[model samples]
Target: MTTPYLLILLVIGLGAGVSSGIFGIGGGILIVPALMYWAKFSQHAAVGTSLAILLPPVGLAAVTEYYRSGNVDLKVAGIVAAGVLVGGWLGASIANQLNGHTLKLVFGLFVLLMGAYLTASAARAI
Candidate 1:
């Protein structure tokens, strides 16, 4: 792969990783949006890709099928790993500076917002 493409993937991963570490999440919440906008991935493609990367230990056999079906994006996964490796460090540093109670409150608000969004999206799809 070219350096530019590699760098872009790393950037996507870093951004996702930052939020992942901060919010104690590892998938869809950040990765999906980043992939959709930056990587030009469809929602299902992005989700399947993210799941494949994160759930390998637990769902190797399942993801293997998805990979065969062209649901997984290996390039995106590589980029995510590169970015996550760096972003996780930065996020952990920032999170360490916040008070425990405040962090919990912020996390709670984020969870509520995500739930609302998910609910609305599901309702619309139905």
Candidate 2:
């Protein structure tokens, strides 16, 4: 990749990392939009790449912290994690079958809905 492309990736990565650390949210929320806006990546590509960056170790540190705090519900988490693994694989397979435009539309709608739900929930809590 060119230096400019590498710099863009670095900035995106840094933004995603900081957002994840501060919000306890996945990079998908920030990364996908930034990739589409700044890097001119297709939505499908952004989502796929974001998922690639999120596997395994992303949860390791958080899991350890929870475990140390005696807040790790291993059995519950194990079952949920298993479901997430299966569901994620199935979702990816389905997305892979979709065209770029269709995937972008679907992902965009999903993100909008999620953002609305989160905002509503936060409003309720406050």
The global Cα lDDT (0 to 1) of model 2 is 0.82
CA shift of 112, model 1, Å: 0.7
Model 1: per-residue Cα lDDT over 1-126, one tens digit each: 788768877887776555554554556567665666677775556655766656543235444666788977889978987897698667657756776556546655776898999899999999
Regions of model 1 farther than 4 Å from truth: 1-65
Off by over 4 Å in 2: none
Query: All candidates' lDDT scores?
Result: 0.66, 0.82
Note the residue pairs that clash in candidate 1: 14-83
Give the TM-score (vs. native) of candidate 1: 0.48
Q: Could you tell me the lDDT of residue 107 within candidate 2? A: 74
